[model samples]
Target: MYIHHSDVQVVFMFTERFIRYIQFEKRYSPHTVSAYQSDLDQFTGFLNNPQKLSPPPPPVITHPSQITHYHIRNWMVELMNQHIIARSINRKIATLRKYFKFLLQEGVIEINPASKINTPKIPKNLPVIVEDVKLTQMLDDNEVFGTDFKGLRDKLVIEMLFGTGMRLSELMGVKDSDINEYEGTIKVLGKRNKERIIPVNNELKLLIAEYQELKKKQDFFGNNSLTLIVTDKGANAYAKLIYLIVQKYLSYISTQNKRSPHVLRHTFATSLLNRGADLNAIKELLGHANLSATQIYTHNSVERLKSIYKQAHPKA
Candidate 1:
């Protein structure tokens, strides 16, 4: 229950170095770096250590080489008993696996206990989506737009989401140069910095093009100036703003389920699938790393079929 101060410092130093390795050497996005940092912080917190420190307690591990399967088993048991969801615990295990792999490469640990530990299996739940009538109502609810810069910006935000099926992060990261006029496509840098071109329908592109013209008339200037979506204050929109925008609009239109920005993405995927778009084609447009991730939209179609059967079948 005690680690040398020097050892703790080494761990901290290594983490900083590893973060840089992932960001620059590995070309990971800032979001990924932040997630890894958070996972490491949680893991370090669980280590029972006795150390003399000023205000905040520091980690102190005795016999670092002795980290064994029992420790990992005990951690899993603690997490399970606390009712932590299986998905979260699974992610925590992944974090540890990555960390230990790094430690092994550095010769800090003789063996990776995490490799021997089994991760909890999480059941997949059906994604919540807005129904057709409610979705129509929400998209048509332009009353959220009022006579002001903020209102115009908010309305454009929702319009872009429902119109384009862009991820909340993708919408926020958009820039002026990322849009195309002649081809009517958008260049989005998605997860892992993978770039994909999504075709923009004429209606949405014209709206965006017009919005750009209006923005230029204002003659705004800043370091983050090129961002397509922004606050009235002219800063880039955060993920929270996107969430709130969707939440407010969805509340006014739908009572079926909790409506978030992801629901818009789900709505987009399902709508496309129902309209007879190819599944693999939708996969590429959504910037999913794998087809399986995009395949969840099929469940929504199944639910739709169930609803149709319950309502129209004469067997009752």
Candidate 2:
């Protein structure tokens, strides 16, 4: 069954239903949810601190029903007084908005006071891209990678991220059976456990075949995990190891500071966009739930075009 982002977040929840709702149901990343949780906690503390809030010394509001739009406005003021940036304040406001929305859905509150709250404006930051030439040179450079299992795996990690544009989590989840070498396609499980097929080139299939052969030779540390990528000890691949592999190798060819797996993901989309691939096709390959998420690459593509124009055009 297809689970909504909110429902998926709900499934990932642990002990506290509230946070679990934020993470799995609300679909906010754990880091963002942590900040939101902190914001709510701070707001709760502020509510109890009668002096800090505008007086008649309002009574403590321990329930969502007790919250009013006025209290939220007062909290925003408090955040500004602390010299918080508009973006940070907006996030806090967002936390309350989500919180109130959840409460309203659960029938704990009749009105979402945060519903009417206006958020401060913030600047947009585009995704970072690794230049295709640099990646091409790096991958083509045999000296940079060893013929050994670890080295081949490292190269495969970079290749799959750039080649297929799958997220790091999806890469970690790849099993030996996920690749359809004959069709030259890879099926990856993306966010919320959604699966999508990304076409692989003949080169990538060969690389995977080689990696699998090496992987088979790897001793079984524990019941021989079927997970595609694995540690030296033969356990399944994990997030940190995959990150380190990307970072370590990318550092060899490019000096760009951000070399995480997601950067390769961004690079993949940017590369496709730059090469005139259809936006919708890119969206499907990346397994984005919406085209808006995939549209960010168009901005990167525009910037790259402008950069090329400046170098080639001779109006001097």
Clashing pairs in 2: 6-25, 9-24, 9-25, 10-24, 10-25
Candidate 2 global lDDT: 0.78
The 0-to-1 C-alpha lDDT of every candidate, in the order given, reads 0.75, 0.78
Clash count for each candidate, listed in order shown: 2, 5
Question: After superposition on all CA atoms, what RMSD does each candidate show versus the true structure?
Answer: 4.2, 7.3
**For residues 1-316, what per-residue lDDT tens digits would candidate 1 score against the true structure?**
5556777676677677767778897776565677888877765555542221222232444434555666666667777888999988888788778777877887878798898988888898877777656766655566656735666677778777776788877888788899888999989888878889999878778777667766766554344587898766777777778888888878877876678887888888899988889999999989999999989899988877888999999983
After superposition, candidate 1 runs with Cα above 4 Å error? 2-6, 49-59, 62-69, 106-110, 221-223
Name the weakest run of 10 consecutive residues (lDDT summed) in model 2: 7-16
Residue-wise C-alpha lDDT for candidate 2, range 20-94, written one tens digit per residue: 776776575444556767777687667656665554333433345766787788888888888898988987887
Which candidate leads the pack in TM-score?
Answer: 1
Could you tell me which residue pairs clash in candidate 1?
Answer: 3-60, 3-61
Clashes of 2: 5
Residue 295 of candidate 2: its Cα lDDT?
90
